[model samples]
Structures are given as C-alpha cells and as structure tokens.
Target: MNLLFVADPLSSFSVKKDSTLAMMLEAQAKGYAIWHCHIEDIKSVAGAIYAKSQKIKIDMAGSPWYVSTQTKEMKVAAFDAVIMRKDPPFDMSYVTATWFLSQAKLEGAKIFNDPVALRNHSEKLSLLEFLQYAPPTLISYDLKDIQDFHREHQDIIIKPLDGMGGMGIFRVKSDALNLASIVETLGDSGKRALMAQKFLPEISEGDKRVLVIGGKAVPHGLARIPQGGEVRGNLAAGGKGVACPISEKEAKVAEHIGPLLASRGLHLIGLDFIGGYLTEINVTSPTCFVEITQQTGYDVAKQWLTSLEQYLK
Candidate 1:
C-alpha cells in the first residue's frame, strides 16, 4: 500500500513525541510505501487535485529522520491512503488545504479524519454539541457578555477560537485585576470572538487526554499536570505527562462520542477532560501516542495501524 502524509515539512517534526511520525514509522515497518507532501504542495489542476509529492525513506534511529528518494507531481488517487496530519491553528490556509483534500476524497482516495468533518468541527466550539458533559461555556465577542460570565462563574478560562497548545488561553478569577484586559485582548476589542468556560478546579489535578481510535477508547489516558504557576495543562505549556488508567466516566464519554465522530470520518480523536467535564474535542492532529505508550506499555501507534488495516480491508 502506498500511504501519503499531507503535513508540515519532515525537518520540523519532533521524532520523540510526534504522533504522525510514529504512524509513519509503523506503516514503514509494515512494508508500505511512504509519501510526503506539504499543504502547499497540493494544487488543483483542471479541477482535479494533484500534489508535488515525494517518496521518502525514514530512519527513526538516525539524526535526520527522513530522506526523500524521489519527487514527482502525482494525482491524489495514486496513493491508497492519505493521512491529513497537519497541525492546527485552523486558519484560512488549513481550511483551503482541507478543501483540496476533499477533492481527493471525492476521487476515491481514503483521507484520515475526513476533510469534510475537519472543516465542520471547530475544536473549541465542537464541545457545545455535548454541552451536558461540559462546563458552563460561552462563545462571544462582547466584553460585557464575557465579563458577565466571569462575574457569574467567579473563575473562568478564556481562549481564542483557533488557539492550540495553550496559546492565548488565560485563567481569570473574580478578583483578578486584569480580567477585563484579558477579555479585551482575547476578544480583540469585540472584533475577534473567544470562548469562555467556568473554571473547573479539577484542572489543578490534571488535564486528561483520552485518545479514541476506530470508535473505541484506548484503555489509558495521559494526564498532563500543570507546572509551577501555569494554569494550562498542555504539554507545550510545561505540563508533566503521566499515564492514567481511563476512568469509567471518561471511558463512557469516549465510547459515546468515538463511533459518532468516526462515522463522520474522524476515526482518530483526542478528547480533553478536566475532572469529568469534557473540555475540548481535538480532531486535527491529536497527540500523546508515545507518552501514553511509554508509560502504559500500550503500543498505541501499532494498534492504530492494525485498526487502519482492518478498516481498509
């Protein structure tokens, strides 16, 4: 099988923890041909999607992770599967890339996480669909509305619509002197919209990442604990990763959401939780494959590939 990965440049990948790299290595070990392409590499030629793609060889144990063997402009249907592993800020370019991939999807190439679903699902606002499982949340551009939420909740977390890795996330307390400033900055003086959630003190315990693959929950979830004075438990924000057995509640949540999401073309998803409340639904580039595997002895990437093989069959 020939598998194409539409993602960032190979040189930019962090081999130690990148889930896409892990999946690629697993596919290589299984003797599949590996192809690489950047989002910009994709183009529409006479209304058909084509990519300036490269056939690549990888050495995970080596200093340089990948070496391109050859490059060519190929139709998207040339590959058996296309893994859309592009990381997110969910900007205009990302949306345009998805539109390109959607053309490939229509032309009979399998695309992971379904380009159509990715466009429909906003990682932050997607939680609204399951509001019963989430904390009190508000998406607004008005500073007055946000301030009212903060006053009602006493503590809240505010973030921009497209932020990831905890960037642009702020925790505001009722007594915080800069609460109004935070709202202004995140809301961009009422021009840019932001999401605000009632702060769950359970965040102090940990922010759990529950990975669901092929409509089933992985038995273990990675609990990222905030470090020092940081309020964000994102690994990029200096949080410590600890593998925790999935709680019954979390497992139920994953089981309920996983298949539904998979049916929409999101076979792999990362559901974030603080306490028992669902925080965010990450469909674009959900991570923590290595961290959980190292701690819990579960080869998540291998399992994912095994499932993918079954899915393809």
Candidate 2:
C-alpha cells in the first residue's frame, strides 16, 4: 500500500517520540511505500487535489532521522491512504488544509480522522458532546461570564480553544491574584473565546491519554505527570510520561465516545482524561504511540496499522 502523510516538515520530527515517525516505521516494515508532504505542499488543480511530496526512508540510527530518496508531485488520491498527521493549534490555515484533504477524500483517498470530522471536531469543545463525563466547563469570551465560572468553580483552568501540548493553558483559583488579568488576556477583552473547566486536583496523579484506535480503546494509558508545580501535564511542557493500564472509568469514557467518532471517519484519536473526566478529544495528530510502546511494550502503532487494515477490508 502507498501511504501519504500530510504533516509538518519531516525535519521537525524527533524519532524518539514522534508518533507519525513510529507509524511510518511500522508501515515501512510492512513493505508499504511511504510519502511525506507538508500541508503547504498540497494543491488543487482543476478540482483535483495534489501534493509536492517526497518518497522517504526512515533511518532511526541517523542524526536527522529520515532521508528523502526522491521528490515528485503526485495526486493525493493516488495514494491508498492519506494520514492527516499535522499537529494542531487548528488555525485557519489548518482548516484550509483539511478542505484540500477533503478534496482528496472525495477523489478516493482514505483519509484517517476524516478531513470533515477534523474540521467539525474542536479538540477542547468536542468534549461537550459527552459532557456527562466531563468536569464543569464554560466556553466564553465575556469577562463577566469567565469570572462567574471561576467564582463558581473556586479553582479553574482557562485555556484557548485551539491549543495543544498544553500551550496557552492557565490555572486560576477564585482568589488568585491574576484571575481577572488572565481572563482579560485569554479572552482578549471579549474578542477571543476561551474554555474554563473546574480544576480537577487529580491532575496531581497524572493526565491520562487514552488512545482510541478503530473505535476501540487501547488497553493502556500514558499518564503524563506534571513536573515542578506545573499545572500542565503535556510532555512538551516537561511532564513525565508513565505508561499505565487504562482505568475502568477511562475505558468507559473512550468506549462511549470512540465508536461514535469512528462512525464519523475518525479512526484514530487520543482522549485526554483528568480525574476520569473527559477533557479533550484529540483527533488531529493524537500522539504518545512511541512513549506508550517503549514504556509498556504495547505496540500502539502496530495496533493502529492493524486497525487501518481492518478498516480497509
């Protein structure tokens, strides 16, 4: 099978922990052709989508990690599968990328976490779909509303709707010295919207990332434990990743949400849970494959590829 990965520049990937690289390695091991392209490399020609891409070989022992063997322009639909592996702050450009990928989808390319679903699913707000499993949350651009939420929750987390790797996340207490300032900053004087969720002290334990592949939950979770008094448990924010078996509650959350999303074309996703409450549904480039596999010996990348095989059959 020929797989096209629409992702960031390959130069930016760290093979040690990059999940996309892990997937590429697995696919390569299976003798599948691997092609790489950035979102900007995508184009639409006379209603057909194409990408200026490279045929690449991944060498783990090398310094740069991947070596490009050849370069060419190919119709996106020519590939058997198009993996949308772009990391997100889901900006307008990302939205545009999905639109182009949607064109490829219409032209017979199997796009994982379907382009339409990616556009429709907001990482933070999608949790509202299963609010019964989430903490008390409020999304607003109004300072008064945000202040009201903070006051009601006593301890709350305020974050931008379009952030990943724990960027732009703030934890504020009802009596915090900068609560109002933070609201003003995140909301940008009522011009920008932000999410506020009642703080789950269980964060001290870890922020569990439960991966849902092919409508089923992976048996283990990557518990990213925050370090040095940090409120963010993202590995990018210096949190430590500890692989642990999924809890019954975490499994329940993924079980309830996974198939629903899968039916909508999201074949792979990472559901973030804090204190067993669904915090986010990461459809765009959900990670932790390498971390989970290395720490627990559960090859999530292999499971994902196997799921994709089943999906294709």
Candidate 3:
C-alpha cells in the first residue's frame, strides 16, 4: 500500500525524535511502502491535485543521507492513505494543502485527520466546547480582556490560537505588565484572537499527552514536564517526557471526546491537559504517539492503519 505523508520541509522523514517520524518508521517496518511530499511540492493542475513527490526511504545508519528526488508530479489517487503530518502554524499553505487534499479524498484516498476536520479545528482553537475540562480560556485580541483575565486568574497563559509544539506560548502573572505591547506584538488590532487560559498549577507534575488513535485511547501516555521555572512543557521547548499513568478522570475525558473526534473522521489525535484541564485538542497533525510508544514499547501504528483499512474497505 502506498502511504503519502504531507509534512514540513524541516520534517521530511529522518527526524526520528518527532512523532510523525516514528509513525512512518512503524509503517515502514510493517513493510508498507512509505512515500513523502513537502507542502511546496503539492500542487493542483487541471482541477486534479498532484505532488512533486519521490519514493523516499530512511536509513538509520546514514552517510550520503536521503536517496530519492527529481520531483515528478503524480496523480493523487495513487495512494492508499495520506497522513497529514505537517506540524502547525496552520498558515495559508497548510490550509491550501487541506483544500487540495480534499481532491485526494474524492479520489477515494483515506486521509487521516480528515481535511475538513483539520480545516474545522486549528490546533489550539478547536476544542472549546469542553471548557469545563479546560482552564478558563478567552479567545480574544483586546488587551483589556487579556488584562482582566490575568486579574481574575492571577496567573494566565497566552498562546497564539493557531500555534503548535508550544510555540509563542507565554505565561503572565498579575505582576507582569506590558500585556498591551505583548498583544500588539502578537498581531494587528483585532486581526487575530489569542488563546488566554488560567494557568494550571499542576503543571509541576507535568501535562499529559493522551493519544487517541482510531477512537480508542491507548494505555501508553506521556507526561511532559516543564523544567524548573518554566510553564511550557513542550518537548521542543526543552520539556522532559516521562511515562505517565492515565486515570479515570483522564480516560473519561478521552471517552467523552473520542467519539466526537472519531465522528469527525479524525483517526489519530493527541489531547493535552495540565492539572486535569484541557488546554488543546490537536486534530491537525496530532503527534506524540511515538513518544508514548517508545516509553511503553506499544505499537500503535497497526491500530491506526487497521482502522483506516476497515473504513476504506
């Protein structure tokens, strides 16, 4: 089966520590012919979507490094599954890819985390319904509103609603001023909505990345702990990962949202929370499945593939 992964250029296939790389690795190990394409390589011609992709392979013990190229455009229907593995900023290019990948879906290709679902939920913006499970959050651009949230919560986290990998996330204490400048620095007035949430103190214990694949919560999970004096616990942001235990509370949260996410055709996603409060619902290229697998030696790749297979059949 041909599986095409749409991802960032910096991502490609060799970046092993990242979750997307791990999923690709498992697919390769299971002998599924894995192919890759960069966002820039994707194009639409004559109303049919195409990509300048090549049959790429990963060599763990590398030297000359990657061994494929020439970038020829191919029909979108040729693949069995297209994993939308691109990491977020959720910018125009990413949105454009999803718009075009919708064609691949029309051609009967199984695109995980369905294009519509990704379009519906930008990384930090989609799961607002379960606010009860989340810290007090406000999606706004007004500096006054942000200031008021800080006043009420005393401590708060300001995140760009479209960001991922914990980028552009800031924690503000009541003593911290200059929020007006910070909000302005984020964007033009009213041009964007910043995601502001009450800071959860339980972050010292760590934030949990609960992997929901194919609508089932896996036993494997990771606790992303912030280093001393940090509020962000993203691995790319220097957070450490420890295997974590999922409790009834966490599982119940998962169960509540699992069917909703699954119903949207988002087969693989990682929901994050701090102190038992939902911070984000990662539908667009939800990662971290590999981190948990490596920590617990659980192979979830088959679960995802098998689920897609069943649906497609």
Candidate 4:
C-alpha cells in the first residue's frame, strides 16, 4: 500500500514523541511505501490536486531517523491513503490547505479526519456539541459577557479560541485580579473571540488525553499532570505524563462520542478531560502514541495502522 503523509517539515519532528513518526515507522515495518510532504507542497493545477512529496525510509536506530529516497510530484489520488497530520495554529493558511485537501477528496483521494470535518470542528468550541459531558462554558468576544461568566462561576479558565498545547490560558479566581486585561488581550478588545469555562479543580489530579481509534476507546489514557505551580497540564507546558487505565466516566463518554466522530471521518481522536468534564476534542493531529505505548506496553501505532488497514479494506 502507498501512504502519503501531509505534515510538517521532517526536520521539526521529535522522533521520541512524534505520533506521525510513530505511524511512519509502523507503516514501514508493515512493508508499505510511505511518502512525506509539507502542506505547502500541495498545489492545484488544471483542477487536479498534486503534492511534491518525498518517498522516505524511517530508521528507528539512527540519529537522523528518516532518509529521503526519492522526490516526486504525485496526484493526490495516486496514493492509497493520504493522512493529514499537520500540526496547527489553525490560521487562514491551514484553512486554505484544508480547502485544497477537500478538493482532493472530492476527486477521489481518501483523506483521514475528513478535510471538511477538520475545517468545521473547532478544537475548543466543538465541545458545545456534547455539553452534557462538559463543564459550563462560554465562548464570546464581548468582555462584558465574559466578565459576567467569570462573576457567575467565581473561578474560570479563559483562553484564546485557537490556542494549542495550553498556550494563552489564564485561570481567574474569584478575586478577578487582572480579569479585564486578560479578557481584553484574549478577546482582542472584543474583536476576537475567547472561550471561558468554569474551572474544574480536578485539574490538580491531571488532564487526561483519552484516545479513541476506529470507534473504540483505547483502554488507557495518558494523564498529563501539572508540575509545580502550573495550572496547565499539557506536556508542552512542562507537565509530566503518566499512563493509566481510563476511569468508567472516561470510558462511557468515549464510547458515546467515538463512533459518532469516526462516522464523520475522524478515525482518530484525542478527547481531553478534566475531572469527568470533556474539555477539548482534538481532531487535527491527536498525539500521545509514543507515550501511551512506552508506558502501557500497548502498541498505539500498531493499533492505529491496524485500524487504517481495516479502513482501507
């Protein structure tokens, strides 16, 4: 099988924890041809989509990790599967790339986490669809509305709508110190929108990343625990990751949302939870494969590839 991975520059991959790299290594072990490309390498010409991609080999024991064997510009449909694994700020450029990918999909290219779904689902705001499992949340650009929410909740977490890895998150207590400034900065003085949720004190336990693949929950979740005075439990925010069995609450929510999301073409998803409340729906590049596998002895990459094979079949 031929697989094309549309992702960031290979130089930027941290093989130790990169989920895409893990997928590539697994695909290689299975004797499948693998190609790599940046989203910028994609182009539309004469109504056909093509990517200037490189056929590469992943060397797990090597320092460089990957070696490019050949470069070719191939039609998007030529590959058996096109995996969109680009990390994001989800800006206009990313949106435009999805549009191009969507065009490719229309032309018979099989893309995971459907381009249209990725474009439509806001990682932070998509939680509204399943609010029964989420905390009281508010998404608004008006400082007054946000302030009202803060006042009502007493303790809240406010953040920009497009932030990732726990960036631009502020925890405001009842004292409301610098609340106005935080709202102004995150909301761009009412021009941009922000998301505010009633703070879940369960964050002191950890923020769990529950991965669902092929409409089923992976039995274990990697809990990213905040370290020393940190409010964010994201690994990028210097938190520690510990893998543990998913609680019954986490399991129930995953079972309910998994197939629903997979039917929409999001075959892989990372559902974030703080105390039993669903916090975020990570569709665009859901990770933690390496951490989960290393700690739990569960081969996440293998499971992912198995799901992909079944999907392709």
Per-candidate TM equals: 0.98, 0.98, 0.92, 0.99
| CA lDDT, candidate 3, residue 181 | 72
Which pairs clash in the backbone of model 1? none
How do the residues 43-126 of candidate 1 rate in per-residue lDDT, one tens digit apiece? 999988999999999986666878889999998877888888999878889999999989888898788879999999999889
Is candidate 2 or 4 superior in lDDT? 4
Q: Which tens-of-lDDT digit does each residue in 196-288 have in candidate 4?
A: 999999998999999999888999899999999999999999989999999999999999999999999998999999998999999999999
CA lDDT of each candidate? 0.91, 0.90, 0.77, 0.93
Predicted structure with the largest TM-score when compared to the true one: 4
Provide the lowest-lDDT 10-residue window in model 2: 173-182
Q: Against the true structure, candidate 2 has what lDDT? A: 0.90
TM-score of model 3 (CA atoms):
0.92
lDDT of 3 by residue, 10-105 (tens): 334336566676777677777877777887787878877887777767665765344564455787777777888877777898889888888778
lDDT of 4 at 277: 90
True-vs-predicted CA distance for residue 83, candidate 2, Å: 0.2
> Candidate 4, clashing residue pairs?
none
Residue-level lDDT of model 2, residues 89-145, one tens digit each, is 688889999999998888988899799999998888888788999999999888888
